[model samples]
Target: MINKLYFTSLDEQVQQKAFRAIEEEQRSIGYYTLPDQDITPILSYCDSIPDMIETIAVIGIGGSSLGAKAIYEFVKPLNNLSRKLYFFESTDPINITTLLSKIDLEKTHFLVISKSGNTVETFSIYKYIYSLQNDPSAYTFITDPDSPLEKYANEINASVLHLPDNVGGRFSVLSTVGLVPLALCDIDIQALLNGAQTIKQSFFNDGYLKDTLLKKAVFYAKNHAQFHINCIFAYSETLKYFCEWYVQLWGESLGKHQRNSAFHVGLTPIGLIGPKDQHSFLQLIMEGTRDKSVTFIKIEDFHDNITISDITLPHLETLDILNGLPFSKLINMQCDSVMEALEVQGDIPLDSITIPTVNEHSIGSLIYYYELLTSLVGELIDVNTYDQPGVEAGKIILKKKLRVLKK
Candidate 1:
């Protein structure tokens, strides 16, 4: 996995600096928040049978919704839960209506998440949902204890969970940003945290050779200068939202300039369901006009297993053809073979990230690793990943436009 030359320019010093920053950030804010840890109470609240929850809705914009969405996609199929998980962050009325139509009002529960409690998009959705139910208590709030949403939750007699003030929304996944909703869905929060801790130790430990976050930033700065696009092609369907989470991370963090240079960091995320993408976007990816870097994510193992017997084959006396290979081996070999072909073609640069397994710790590690890598890459490109100054401008402009329209 480390042989890829996409990051040839990254030196030991650059990597060390990146690692130091990641360690500092983790030290500063990591302990300030708790994610799947201390989540037993939340899970207990959701211990009711599946049939009782006709629908589960999560409401928040940007980081709040995106991280939860990523977790939902990553862990949903594994749990085999019967109820549907719906997200209500989008502004489209049709999409909101379609989701509402499927939910049973009497049995459904809404989890409204917003760190500040007053984000325009999030509050707008909360109002819409409130109008639908005509009872604020029907919704639960996850935000800062002092935020307006917390007060609103109290006023409506709904349940409320407080988010850590020091942790930013994008970095809140390790906190209630992701854990609460996931717990409700019966996901193993403990396992996810364990994975995260593994990643954390890997970054902080001195002897580790591969600093994924640093390598990621170096690769992005170099590749973006050449290819101008960074695409995350997650092989598993469950990881589709992982791409989305990365999109916000990369775009918001690095898409700026420090020294007033003409060039600005640019990255576009395109989620590809592998094996599936081999049919759909592979052609454009291989032969398209744009220069692109692709990151491929694969889970080393899945929670479920399936076996097919050779004896069931229709072909007569086919034992010799299928004698040696196991089904799991065959599937993995096929994927590896495809990757080899892509490498041989040299159509684009690629990175392969294999997860030993997906759980809370791994997820935490993945998030932290990416966050650290992003910061390093942003620093390299002279961009600020820590702040979203551009986003606030849009909000200010929108408020002024709204006032004008009201007049």
Candidate 2:
């Protein structure tokens, strides 16, 4: 596998729970199977895009935008893409105004994605954009087949990409949600899916699960209560948005209430960029309360050979040791040093995952790895991993608040 997982191991029982999760998920419309989907529709739609379209403004939030954003950010540099992909996900007027100022509506293609198709902030943003360009061809709606957004798209003769009703927004990345934007940007989405398939197939195989996925899921399940926070220290800046997507996926999928019990359960997820945050959040993880489970992610080969200059100033003579060293080496060294320090400090549950490179394949493998881990941990905790009742309740409340404001 291009993505390698390293961690401390656990007992058979926990591993068995992970296996159970895999079995259960196999029967449902779980995201793990998404890699096996035929993406002809996504590709065909991308092929039909007019050559004059220079920008793709994705209108979505949370699961809707994060996965696609993660994909674009992680591997855009690897491919020579000419079209710009922007996100219009906020209700903040300044955010909308700033995004609007960047692109010409005439040359921009909009992808309005909302799983429920009734997302308040999503449609609110879309409504404003609609005012500027009501041309159906200028927009594509990615939503559930019969959703209000889909109905509206059909009425306007706008193009439509359907999300499987069972697939949640966070898990819908391998679906049309992420693939459409990625394919439009000239990304080899099939390669991304193939990478995910490699992991998924290996995971389902008898031998591969024991060492990697099982070890990870079991660690979180066994230590969920004691280690209340799960933090990811991703070393590469390219992984910044990937960490954000992980936060949403891990936080929302696992956090839940059990109807039979009085206590609410979930691990709070924190995302930090390493070397940068090593100066900040790493201190808290090192000496603060022993309530966190940390995962350190490093890219083995950044594929860039930029190096520090051999010249050193009189006052900065101490930094001369790093002169001529590749920045990639320095960053990897920082990641390794941090992992070693964490190991020495002890008590905190820590693991490391190394990716050979930040290509579509490795990014795809990493995405499925986290998604599978979330499912496994949820199984062990006995929570409904696929649903977000708490979030739904909040959405209901927001609608009422908006109605009151309108009155």
Cα lDDT of model 2 overall? 0.87
Model 2 misplacement above 4 A: 1-9, 207-210
List per-candidate RMSD values in Å: 4.0, 1.6
Best by TM-score: 2
What are the lDDT figures for the candidates, one per model?
Answer: 0.70, 0.87
What tens-digit string does per-residue lDDT give for candidate 1 at 256-365?
75656766566665667677778888788777875787776677776645655545445666564655456545555655766777677776787777766655555566
Candidate 1 ranges with C-alpha deviation above 4 Å: 1-10, 27-54, 207-212, 259-263, 303-334, 358-364
What TM-score does prediction 2 earn?
0.96
TM-score of model 1 (CA atoms): 0.83
> Model 1, poorest ten-residue lDDT window?
1-10
